[model samples]
Target chain A: MAVYTEVPDSALSAFLDAYDLGTLLSYKGIAEGVENTNFFLHTTAGNFILTLYEKRVNEADLPFFLNLMEHLARRGLACPQPVRNRQGEALGRLCGRPAVIVSFLDGVSVKVPGVDQCRALGQALAALHAAGRDFGMTRANSLSVSAWRPLFAQAEHQADSVSPGLAARTRADLDLLESAWPTGLPGGVIHADLFTDNVFFIGEDLSGLIDFYFACTDAFAYDLAICLNAWCFSPDGSFHRDRAAALIAGYEAVRPLEAAEVEALPILARGAALRFMLTRLVDWLNVPPGALVQPKDPREYDRRLTFHRQARDARDYGRA
Target chain B: MAVYTEVPDSALSAFLDAYDLGTLLSYKGIAEGVENTNFFLHTTAGNFILTLYEKRVNEADLPFFLNLMEHLARRGLACPQPVRNRQGEALGRLCGRPAVIVSFLDGVSVKVPGVDQCRALGQALAALHAAGRDFGMTRANSLSVSAWRPLFAQAEHQADSVSPGLAARTRADLDLLESAWPTGLPGGVIHADLFTDNVFFIGEDLSGLIDFYFACTDAFAYDLAICLNAWCFSPDGSFHRDRAAALIAGYEAVRPLEAAEVEALPILARGAALRFMLTRLVDWLNVPPGALVQPKDPREYDRRLTFHRQARDARDYGRA
Candidate 1:
């Protein structure tokens, strides 16, 4: 849960005056989005979400994120559509930050998703990749392979502080992955981070995909690899082969993976694990004292990296 | 924003199995309550709040808090009412802590309430006082005048660290207020903490009163005294005489204060300020490292004390 900035009473009143959303009933800062300050809004217009883009989000990228949601939403994806104000603009400024109101989408995000939920997530993700293939924007994945080293450098001195041999081992792994990282895999707009919390479901049915701040044009299989690492692994670091099988099959049902994509799975998964490790390491080490945010353990990715390092083939991931 | 405890997926799913509240769609830890971990839950049934009582809350008082909410809600307070499971029990255990689900209350808490809101808050608080007069359970005001000395002692060592000479002046103020604190002034069930955030408004109407954990048997006038400091003060520390007048008049419209209660207003207000100052001081000085909970500045209460210390009669509060 995160709400880094507070919208004061006068500010909120002024902010709502710009909108046509009936008389303001109530609004609250929701503990949902990590990268933005999100508020659950209830007005005569209906329930909606008011998001204040925080420092972690790039101001220039606001339109890209907004438009992508609009694009996917128009395609019938259940995502938060930016609510336009009287000026017919979806974006506005508040609390010295870029802010916007969006139609509230109702759905619960599952915690430990069941097998059917896993399958539904895979199908939904692959469909999202296909839907965004024609979007009229391009954002390079800033957290991809090319950016890992720089991210690692920021936290290099404190890496061993997290675990012994963590820094050196990560450096060597980075070198190996960088040298062997696949190029020319089929690329498209990928939901690079499809964790359970980002995908909402109404019971067994997928209701929506949210938090597209990490969306970018990347190897389609790389997105799948991120999911393989994110969704198909148990909390203890063991890969759930059956769940992996279900997820892969579900994705293949929507958009079949190329043979080259299959061949690149292990390396992509390893790279995915390391990418998260480096960023989480930097954030874990650099969290300002007394911050409300609790950084995820970089060690989890360490364990995933170990598992991916030993995998021999896609068969080990339940690839058919 | 605070959510000290996280509810795991397994634990949540298991917890919901006991209730018939539709399939879980989503659950998010809310940034509202400070004493407990509160999640805004959306299930097939509808919206509800799931609270995990933290260690800071005494477990034995769970029934009292829940029952008081029930009592007030039964008397038409728009507060959250505890939801019962199939076994007809509203309280259950989750994450090894006392947990319960309550129906969601709609309406927003204003950051800077207007005069109408001040009047609405005053009327609602007095109504709460009458409604909860017969609540079967009784909890002593833990932060009342008698408790201030011990709380001040806990925070005495580091009080100056908060502000220069804050310790000695607070000590002097506490001695005076505690001795002058009036007794036998029409005591009854009181919503001891009626801060703005605990009161909600929809337009000019008061929608709800919440956070009854601090509800206890105390002087009815003490509750009004807390509101005087809470509602009648501006962010810049100046008292709004008109708003205070409106609040007192609104309150007296529902339940007229006895002559003795009116005479005791200044001391009650002073004691109330010190009670909060001491608790907030102890919390501010003793916050655990990296605690998401930020303690309220005791100096704000110091400012309030400064105001109350000079007032010799209720007219200074714009008393009707």
Candidate 2:
């Protein structure tokens, strides 16, 4: 739950004046999207989402994220379309933070996604990758294989404090991921953090995808790997082969994977596991005295890393 | 900001099955109401607020609160109308907690409320008091004069930790309030917690009053006193006499204050101050480690107590 910045009523009223959206009927600070303060706005014209970029989001990367959402939406991907202000600017200042309003998508995110939802997610994700192929912008994936060691270094000493022998195991995983990380795969603008919560669904239909803060130019298969780690893992940290199979089959229905991409899946899955583990490890060890957000247990990804470490081929993940 | 309970998608979908409210288009955990989990539900039928009663609210008192809202709304008060399910029940279970859905009110709450807004709030509050008069059920104000001493006892040790000499000062105020607190001065059901955030205004018109968890049978003047402390104090802790005057005058236009009620205003205001101060002091000291909701500063009410400590008559509060 994220609402680090409290947008004052007067500030919000003044901010809405700059937009063509009609009289602000009601707005609420929505407890969603960890990286920013989000408000669900209902106005005379229509419902929309007002996002105030927080400290976690890089100000320099604002154009990349805002443009990516607009780009994805224009290309027929169901994503939020940024609403430019009267000055034709999508970005503006509100309460000393960069803020923008976007069209509100209508769907609820599944906590434990079903097999059908997994398929829907895979198809939507593939469509998102296809939609962003021609958008003339690029952001290097900051949490990819290259950043694992540095990220792990921050939590090295305290990692075992969370779980005994976690530090050594993480270091070993990081070493393996760095050495075996794939150099060439079908690369494009990818939703680097498409967790189940980020994708919305109305029943079995995928309504839209949101929270593009971590999106960057990276392997599309690596994005697929992130989904496998996120969606296909059971609460007990066991991998579900059926969910993974459905996800992969759904993706292939949109765009077939190359042999290299298919074979590289296990390593990429391992790398994705390592990436999330490192970040969560660092965050878990450094949660402030009274943070609203409880850090996601790094052990979840650690277990996923363990599974990927032993898997030899895509067939192990139920890829037909 | 409050979202203590996270209603999973399946649980939410199943919960909505009992209602005629069309297919759930979207729902987000709204960051509002400290004592309950609130979700802004937008459905094909219309927008509504789904509130799951948390620990802070007493389960047995649900009927009094829910019935009062329906009663008040029936008598031409602008407030959330509780939507009963097909079983003719307004209260139901969701996520293992007592929950209910109410029609959404459209307006934004003012932060630093303007004089006009204060006037509107005054009128609306009086109307709420009037509308709630005939409501058969009643709940005692749990944070009123009788609760202050026991509440203070809980926070006594750490009272000085917040501010030097606060403990002794709070004790003296408690002594004065216990002995001199007015009784039998135009009593009715009062919106005891009608703070600025609970009163919504679109421009200068008060659209609605919400958060009835603290609504109780108490002196109408005491509720006015709470409003005075809430709306008429500047950030500097100085009283805004003009705003207070506007508020009282606006309130009297709807329901005239009796001579006894007018005369009891200063002491009631002080009692109101002490009530909030003691509760806030207890909350401030006992906020659990890593709490999402920050306990409001007791010192704000402490300062108001200081102002009311010296105030001799209703004239000082701009109550003409």
Candidate 3:
């Protein structure tokens, strides 16, 4: 999260007083973000994360974040559980900002996640998506197919800076994505972000997942695409066919993709790539000096967006 | 430019009362961001973009953003010029947020930029870097080499969820990046976020460059890496070798890469890829639900990061 905002430690201690979690032993801000102020807290009770609602975070969405953690935790997802106060409220004021203290999960995010782990993550994600199917809360996919053009518009002038024929290629890709957008696919709650960092594990075992902030009602296959993008790549940016297979197989084992979803994979992947490319591009352009926030390299996403442009079929993902 | 945080049209007019931009004819919010609220404003004076500082934007950096634009514009970089008030202040409070009005650039962003355009963009970016050389600002690269490990640590638990070999590969890549990082590359002010969206063009001639928020003092070669990543790829995610050459040639025409910088290209690219991968992965895991923001696919970045893992020679980039 962005570190420009100051979230005082005293504020977190005050919230802990409500949770009946004993005295807070210590709290330290996790110095790793360009969006929100996050702190790792330890007390007599256990470990937890203290998140102050930073500027990018909306106050009204506090409950959704807190409650979703509770919901996912109840459903056997190994994730951070938002600890409620003695008054049974998960949301509260801290440092004059909305805040919450969530139970800190144990497990390391892997650097090089394995194929078995990929499969397990896939299975777990599918299960999580399934479990979230009936949750009363519903959020729309913000980076849906329709948002692509508007985003590309933001960076259109620099298209010449991107590559030979990139502008035309993107236009073609957009047309392809628009044409093939899924009309009817299995829709459900998806852990939209499922990047390697969000999921935690103990060695090869999938211990739990954290950071469900991006969870929303969307195409289930899109979640798989996010995972494929997150998990199935080699360090050199090449598509690792085996890893992709293992992940897809694992996902299909629990929640198989419908024929329509399969048909939409290419466009979905393209849309997904464009979504990230736009965000990264935006962030790249808008970084504030001295904010301790890093502007992401827009080119990486450019490459990925370009890749999605080439994917013509689900078969491109490799044998299922 | 998410919609919710946008300043109301009436409020925008009220804020403009402090300035002297004449009568407003039309104003519409541009909903294409996870941070900052942008409005396309047209008045008797002409078109302008009104930006309201959002949470992700730090208030303290207002002067830098505004002044940098003014600076670049004064240098004839075809960048947006910050319109100051009658009091000679480029920054002002608007709806409890920092706000500024920048002159609207005339030109269409290329949808299918050709290789020649890519070269032109490269040259323009180099010129921009040179122009900012004496701008008298010093902001360290926030996403510098030091940030990689901590970021990777955030996701190491799920290492097994990726390919078994990925962990070792990444570790090795990190080590390589560490050892190969160029220490003495020429430093200057860089328009770090020179994505196509932030640039403007009128036919074959470049018009203006926008989005100077990420402008900072950094290695000139690093800036080139950013450009390469932005310009050298096909829409289908394939590396266009010819485009890469053209872009490098264009850049070198203005500011040539040092032998050391050339040698460090692979690692720099790797570092660049890793920076986006980490940020995208983090954002992927943490996007708030029901928010107008879109969660980007981390896999796209994962692929790019992987490509950087493969050691490449400057010869691979071709002669300038």
Best by DockQ: 2
Query: What does the interface RMSD come to for each candidate?
Result: 2.0, 1.1, 23.9
CAPRI quality band, candidate 3: incorrect
Question: Candidate 3 lDDT, tens digit per residue, A163-198?
Answer: 555557667777877887776688877878888777
Ranking by DockQ: 2, 1, 3
Q: In model 3, which runs have C-alpha deviations exceeding 4 angstroms?
A: A162-166, A234-236, B1-320
> On a 0 to 1 DockQ scale, where is model 3?
0.01
- What are the per-residue Cα lDDT tens digits for candidate 2 across B194-257? 8988988776678899988888998999999999999999755799998999899989999999
Residue-wise C-alpha lDDT for candidate 2, range A266-320, written one tens digit per residue = 9999888888888988998888766878888888888887798889999999899
Relative to the true structure, candidate 1 has a C-alpha RMSD (angstroms) of: 1.8
Alpha-carbon runs more than 4 Å astray in model 2: none
In angstroms, give how far residue B98 of model 3 lies from its true place. Answer: 43
lDDT tens digits, residues A1-320, model 1? 68888888678888899999998877777876778899888788888889999889898888888899999998877788998999999999999989999888877777666778878878998888888888999889999998999999898898998999998999999999999999999997888988888887775688998888888889999999998888887667888888888888899999999899889999999999999888889888888866777888889888888899999889989988
The C-alpha lDDT values of all candidates are 0.86, 0.89, 0.70
> Residue A87 in model 3: shift from native, Å?
1.6
Pairs in clash, predicted candidate 2: none
lDDT of 1 at A33: 75
> Tens-digit lDDT track for model 3 on B1-320?
24445354446656777778776654545533356777666565766777777787767666776777777778878888889888998887788877888886654355445788778888888888777866865777767788877877776666436435545656776787778777877887777767666665544776677777776678887877776666665444466678778878888899887788888787676677666666666676565744455665556556666556554687665644
**Per-residue lDDT for B17 in model 3?**
76
